[model samples]
Target chain A: QQQVKQSPQSLIVQKGGISIINCAYENTAFDYFPWYQQFPGKGPALLIAIRPDVSEKKEGRFTISFNKSAKQFSLHIMDSQPGDSATYFCAASSEAAGNKLTFGGGTRVLVKP
Target chain B: DTEVTQTPKHLVMGMTNKKSLKCEQHMGHRAMYWYKQKAKKPPELMFVYSYEKLSINESVPSRFSPECPNSSLLNLHLHALQPEDSALYLCASSQDHWTYSGNTIYFGEGSWLTVV
Candidate 1:
């Protein structure tokens, strides 16, 4: 199946806390996984990405943890702030599909101050 | 610049009206895409163009026509669209679709289309 399933349709966290969003893909061919952040009335922007070869990739407060064997990946936001409140989407792409990204259901995060 | 610019940020057109959404990028990208997004939903792929040629259509309806006039320009012509078709239309571009390293697609602000 060419599908990506995401969990926690929505999340609520406090400032300085960590926000986590999980996703699982059924396609084994997917080699590129990326996370996108989108605000209201704006297009989704590329936040972070990882290849299956690495187990973890971190950039500042944004980190991506990948589990190749389980076909699962997650995004963690450390020291979450109110500005981090937005919709996050997990997407997977494969060379076979011309690198077309298959996005999962978005997770709406609300970081309370 | 790493930006994809779209025109007519907001549009309100009747079902019988004909309008087009334009997108441009000077990032020297060769792969462009058109995606449709409904409220609270992920963007759905509508079409893909590579090297100024149409590559994928995703079985999109004919009323939604996509054109890639050049390597830096893409357009979506809309006609006879229903009210349910009202949503955000996003334009994205990548360096190339054949290579994985250059597949980081960047999206434009998107055009908010309203069908009346």
Candidate 2:
């Protein structure tokens, strides 16, 4: 079963514009949600994360808006740049899973300059 | 360092050949994981190790074996594989086994395995 689902298989954004990706989950046991960015030939790196307790969390230009009751979350990148072009993935995990993340299919983002 | 290092960034093996992928981390993480990813697909969880003990196995095939020799080391053993098994093998580590606070999962560069 796919616990986490993401939309927009690919996204194109102009430089300095906002880029957004959305995701949803089915398991209520999941309490931790994280977003990862991956470049070609590299590993997925943690970008930002949010807990169910908070509705939103911002780190630099990246923000994660989470809804516990709706079981949904999204990542927003402000002032998008060409360097930000990469694949993004959203993942979730429960406390009992020992941080074993269930990931979304991934969204390829292209920030055009 | 906060990096997870993987050996042999690329590997090409035959279906009958046996090979091993190694992962090492220096962040003193107590939990480690192995995931398989196809092109344009999200990573699929294969195994999880906590405190050098096997904690979760996702009903993976026997052809894929995971070993945690220590807190910082993880290994994936492959044997008698098919061409369809070729994919990127990723290793990740987390600070603790119980992740109620969204512990970050640091990943390695990934090992690209091509089975012929």
Model 1 agreement with the true structure over A1-108: per-residue lDDT tens digits: 549999899999999999999999998999999999999989999999999999999999999999999999999999999999999999999878876999999999
- Writing each residue's lDDT as its tens digit, candidate 2 over B5-111 gives 99889999999999999999999999999989899999888998988999889999999999998898999999999999999999999888664547788999899
For model 1, how does the per-residue alpha-carbon lDDT over B1-116 read when each residue is reduced to its tens digit?
A: 33999999999999999999999999999999999999999999999999999999899989999999999999999999999999999999998987764288899989999999
Considering the two chains of model 2, state its CAPRI-style docking category.
medium
Q: Candidate 2 regions off by >4 Å?
A: B99-101
Candidate 2 shows a clash count of 0
lDDT, each prediction: 0.94, 0.92
TM-score of chain A of 1: 0.98
Best-matching candidate per lDDT: 1
A92: Cα error in model 1, Å: 0.2
lDDT of 2 by residue, A6-71 (tens): 988999999999999999999998888999999988999999988899999999999999988889
Model 2's alpha-carbon lDDT is 0.92
Which pairs in model 2 have colliding backbones? none
lDDT at A84, model 2: 96
